[model samples]
Target chain A: MDTIIQTVTSITWQQIVMMVIGGVLMYLGIKKNYEPTLLVPMGLGAILVNFPMTGVLTQTINGQKTEGVLDVLFNAGITTELFPLLIFIGIGAMIDFGPLLSNPFMLLFGAAAQFGIFFVVIVALLFGFNINEAASIGIIGAADGPTSIFVSNQLAPNLLGPIAIAAYSYMALVPIIQPMAIKLVTTKKERRIRMEYQAESVSKQTRILFPIIITIIAGLVAPVSLPLVGFLMFGNLLRECGVLDRLSNTAQNELVNIVSILLGLTISVKLTAGSFLKVQTLMIIAFGLVAFIMDSIGGVLFAKFLNLFRKTKINPMIGAAGISAFPMSSRVIQQMAQAEDKQNFVLMYAVGANVSGQIGSVIAGGLLLGFFS
Target chain B: MSAALTQGFELMLFGMGGVFAVLFLIYLVCIALNRIFSGKPKE
Candidate 1:
């Protein structure tokens, strides 16, 4: 009886704190609907991992300091680059490359948005982080969670938990972050600039060829990116191949849903209080914002440069969507457009650029690995 | 340290230039295709 009481009393304050944080995450998911798909599972996983002496988290190894279940899972899935690539496959299937095909110049916006990745990498390094860790932190600027996961897995596996959390958290907060950045950068008059939409319907053949051509080009140019890019493009191919409707649906909905649950919970298992509540984590969060802001700025500035040459001017606000947050960033641009000029335009152009960013970031990730490795 | 910074800077430039050139080549090909496949205007 005394042993049982002492065992109960042995539970630490840090575990209690993690339990509360888990509860808060659940409340945020159910009540506020802040990224419920990821947050709920992640919250539950955190709770499960934080339980005292569960023996679920511990493992016996021949020669190991302390093996935990999550540590093993992390090593297998995340450190090995399996989860992110699989997630990309689902993302690729969900994306419609038609908009991108209609306007290939949007690729420039995508490329430009990556300025933040390198920029923040330098800043992080200057702030005492080594090259790999800095690179992992900088990828948060891509406004892409999976790419961050993939890059960090390759570049800095130790930073994976914080990097993944920061990436996803910022992506969910894009609707809030991008608008303020857009508004601060562009005047009301510029924001209200109405542009005519060009009608360029892409053929099914073109759609089918796009993934193949892009894969060939990217694979040739940056072989390092093949895993992330290959998986993403393959997923897109599944979507665009016309006869593979069933596969595409499964990839987009069922596959993504299943993987998201597993991935989210797996990531959460790493979020122990000792690992999570750190000074570096705070800096990571701060720099992640900087990276995101820079990506937006890079896209916007590049669009503005294009405006100097092209007769058909694009709304600079749409450029902010070039960070690969997908429809969310595009939707923010659309909402901002509607607020400024209801009849101005929609976010199709931005969506095109947004998808292009998705591809471009993958390519960049590959190139970084190629160059660094 | 300065040398490392220079090397990093050069690396960054090379990357930026490399991707830019690739994007440019793709653009040129796209433009050329647009010109070739875009038939004469309907009478």
Candidate 2:
């Protein structure tokens, strides 16, 4: 009873703050539908870790250090970089590269949109973070949570919790963040620009070959990203091959769902108040928002630049889809297009650009790894 | 600019440039692959 009393009283204001944060995350996830699968577990885990004397975290028992459940999971999963890579496989399997295959030019928009990652690196540096931390913070612009986790885990492990939070929170907010950024750079006439959509007629042979060739190219270009790029493309191969439909289904469903639960909760181990309650965390979150906005601006401006040479005009709104929140960013672009003109349909192009953003994001992450790590 | 910020500018230059260069290569390769498989629009 005395020990329990001590434990209750030992809780600090910072712990209360973290618990409040955890509650807010849970509320945002449950009520607001903000990436609930990931955020819910993360929120619960944050609450679990913040209590003064929890067995979920590493503790000294009988003067001997005993690893807690979260620590063991973190070591085996996040430290070894297993969880993010596994999630990547699921992401790859779920992505239908059909639209991207129909319009390979969308790949350019995807690459162009990664401008935020680099741009934000400088901004983070100006804010007094070191190069590695800046890079980790900047990867929030990738808008690919797994890649953000993967990059930050290696580059700035200490900043992992904030980076992960910022990455995911901003990703869930893409619909709100992107439009304001897009509208800033694009005129209403540019928003209503339309392009013809071709039916996806990519052959099964091309489908099978696409993943394999892209992996090989990634290997040649950025061998360091081979593990990340290779696993993702392997999952795509499993999907496209049509021979391993069962495996692909398992990857997309059970494997992904289970891994997401573990990944979300495991990262929260870093969210203990001691590490997380800091001035820098708020700055990181702000930087992530800036990164996201810049990504939208970059893609939109690139489209406007390309429009200089084209006979047929391309919708600049589709360029904002290149920031890689997947179908969500693309959907926002489509909705905005409809808002501008009811008859205009840019869903196909937006989807193609959004899908390309996935590949471009990984490639951009690979490039950063090449530069920094 | 501080040395770190200077390095960052270089990063923006090369990083953005690297993404474009590699993706452009991928674009060329993808076009090549499409021609071999689909055969309609001239590359």
Global local distance difference test of model 2 = 0.90
Q: In candidate 2, which residue ranges exceed 4 Å CA deviation?
A: B39-43
DockQ of each: 0.28, 0.50
On residues A155-220, what C-alpha lDDT tens digit does candidate 1 reach at each position? 877777788878877888888888877777788987887867676766666666667766777778
Tell me how far the alpha carbon of residue A135 in candidate 1 is from the true structure, in angstroms, after superposition. 0.4
Q: Which candidate is the best by lDDT?
A: 2
TM-score, cand. 1 vs. native: 0.91
Whole-model lDDT per candidate: 0.77, 0.90
Worst 10 residues of 2 chain A by lDDT: A196-205
- Chain B of candidate 1 versus the native chain B: what TM-score? 0.74
Alpha carbon lDDT at A70, candidate 1: 72
Each candidate's iRMS in angstroms? 3.4, 3.1
Tens digits of per-residue lDDT for model 2 on A153-183?
Answer: 9999999999999899999999899989999
